[model samples]
Target: MPNQPKTPVKGFRIPVDLYDAALAKAQSEGRTLTDVVREALHRYIDAD
Candidate 1:
């Protein structure tokens, strides 16, 4: 449904190497990996 509030989701799988890379990038930016993922999701939705 449109305008539905986002709820937490878990257990989405990625390749181990990609996950590690994202974690490193997030750490270098001084943000939790969750925060980085959330921001990316928001930007993607906003752009659509």
Candidate 2:
């Protein structure tokens, strides 16, 4: 069987200063902060 990630999710908060600019940018783009952060993290960690 293939390994799989655990589910039934949990979450934590980022320090406001860590991504405050990104949150503001997300608001300007009419995106939810969560959506913006999720996309950013996806690209970031997936990068070679």
Strongest candidate by TM-score: 1
- Each prediction's Cα lDDT score? 0.87, 0.76
**Clashes by residue pair, model 1:** none
Q: How many residue pairs clash in each candidate?
A: 0, 0
lDDT of 1 at 48: 69
In Å, residue 5's CA in model 2 sits off its true spot by 16
Q: Best by lDDT, which number?
A: 1
lDDT for 44 (candidate 2) = 96
Residue pairs that clash (backbone atoms under 3 angstroms), model 2: none
TM-score of 1: 0.73
lDDT of 1: 0.87
List model 1 lDDT by residue over 1-48, tens digit each. 359788777768899999999999999988889888888889999996
